[model samples]
Target: MENENKIKLFLVDDDALFLKSLEIEFMENADFTIETFATGELCIAQLSNNPDIIILDYQLDGIDQTAMNGIETLDKIKAFNPNIPVVMLSSQDKIEVAVNCMHHKAFDYVVKSETAFMRLQKIISAIFEYRKMKKELNWYMDRM
Candidate 1:
């Protein structure tokens, strides 16, 4: 049974199996509330509703996103909510692409595989820490 109070997650991926599998895995393993889409466009549409985290695939169908790939999507997502944590996911292991995605503000870029679930857990933990730190820093800055 899925817990009613699990952290919300919005996952974006073109592969249906990947999206569905990850959703189930996260739900079963981490007690997370998940909403998944097979395309970036759909995921982007739902992002305005304020999901706690976004797992975005580097590629999407029907969206000529290769030139910018996931970076363009990241820009748009950040524009709407800069503080919302986003983790980029891709089958490719190219460092340049990963670097570019990070430069564009992805919390982390993860390579998809059998260990993807563990990586995601680490990402969630890291993002949680990052947000906590940001809040602390913000509080300090306000006092200063």
Candidate 2:
């Protein structure tokens, strides 16, 4: 049975092949409900769907120049809902890029690699656990 409690995730990348691969990989896990978007704008437009997390590509090649890159999109997402966790993915492994993403409140910056999927899965699990703990703590605090 599909779990209604599964975390909803938005995967935004301009690379069709990469997006499909991610969708397939994430779909293997029952804990995630994945939604794919080809551009940051499309993803942002659907923020009303209220995904629990977002995996956004740092470089949106072939997309319109006006379209937001990962950092810009991340800023918009945070402005819209700071609580929603965003993970930035990029082929570029520059420390500066990773720092920029962190500065914009990215939950994590992942370099695209053969191990990227495994790393992302682990991060997702950690995020969920952390959120659950925070919720429980808040509940206890409210009662106290």
Candidate 3:
């Protein structure tokens, strides 16, 4: 939670209000160095910063009709660095949509709702825990 090691979060959403709200929630409830982008292109451009996690909106055409959607952004992120975790966020709670996100290798899919912030928090925690386990496993394997 300390500034030196706070989680760096990238939030990509076309909705300014929602993006700001989500940013505020994370800032207040958790310790995250957050950067928000209104377009997927902007987010992709900043990939060099290496955010710890990316929460991308499913629909990104709100601000720009021609802009790439969340899935496209997710793909680009993966292409740049498949190791970075990307979480898809959308108002759609349909199972098919969730499955599609998983198919594209999203870390997780989160529905935009009152409980979204809490759900995201849990998902982020799980991601780090999994990473820790993987690192430990690799270390043991190296020893072996």
Candidate 4:
């Protein structure tokens, strides 16, 4: 059996080009094993406990055989496992969307543009840091 330290990542987006490009970039430069889906429903189907982090596009196509969006998808994920880190991506720098995602416990939000390349690295680092802190906290709690 593999340990929890593998650090898998899943990306749910509708953009085909970005999906291909991101897979290439991460495979070339990052330590994470990446799985991607073109729609939220597809992502949900491929879901596993191994993915420590998820990147959610703010808008998604069909889910549940109905129109589904990222906010709703985020809610579904929270219901599944609130501890898994979710990073929201938006086409525009919408503060309201950011606030809503943060309220629902999204790890971070990144604008889907020039800033995306930069934010991806930062968010991945933050997720690893958060996991480390959480492990330390759990260890302390266990000993107490």
Name model 3 segments beyond 4 Å from true.
1-3
Candidate 2 lDDT by residue in tens digits, 70-120: 888899999999999999999999999999999999999999999999999
lDDT of 4 by residue, 1-144 (tens): 354445688988887887788777777877767889877777777666457889998877633345568888788888888888899988868899899889988989988886686788888897788788989999999999
> Each prediction's Cα lDDT score?
0.83, 0.91, 0.95, 0.80
Which of the predicted structures, 1 or 3, would earn the higher lDDT when compared with the native? Answer: 3
The residue ranges of model 1 lying beyond 4 angstroms of the native Cα positions read 1-5, 62-69, 140-144
Per-candidate RMSD, Å: 3.2, 1.7, 1.5, 2.7
Pairs that collide, model 1: none
lDDT by residue for model 3 (19-122), tens? 99999999999889999999999999999998999999999999889999999998999999999999999999899999999999999999999999999999
Candidate 2 wrongly placed segments (more than 4 Å) = 1-3
TM-scores of the candidates are 0.85, 0.92, 0.96, 0.86
Q: How accurate is candidate 3 locally (lDDT)?
A: 0.95
Q: Quote the positional error of residue 111 for candidate 1 in Å.
A: 0.5
The TM-score obtained by model 3 is 0.96
Task: Assess candidate 1 and give its TM-score to the true structure.
Answer: 0.85
Counting clashing residue pairs in each candidate, in order, gives 0, 0, 0, 0
User: After TM-score superposition, what is the CA distance of residue 91 in candidate 3 from its true location, in Å?
Assistant: 0.3
* Residue range with the least summed lDDT across 10 consecutive positions in model 2: 60-69
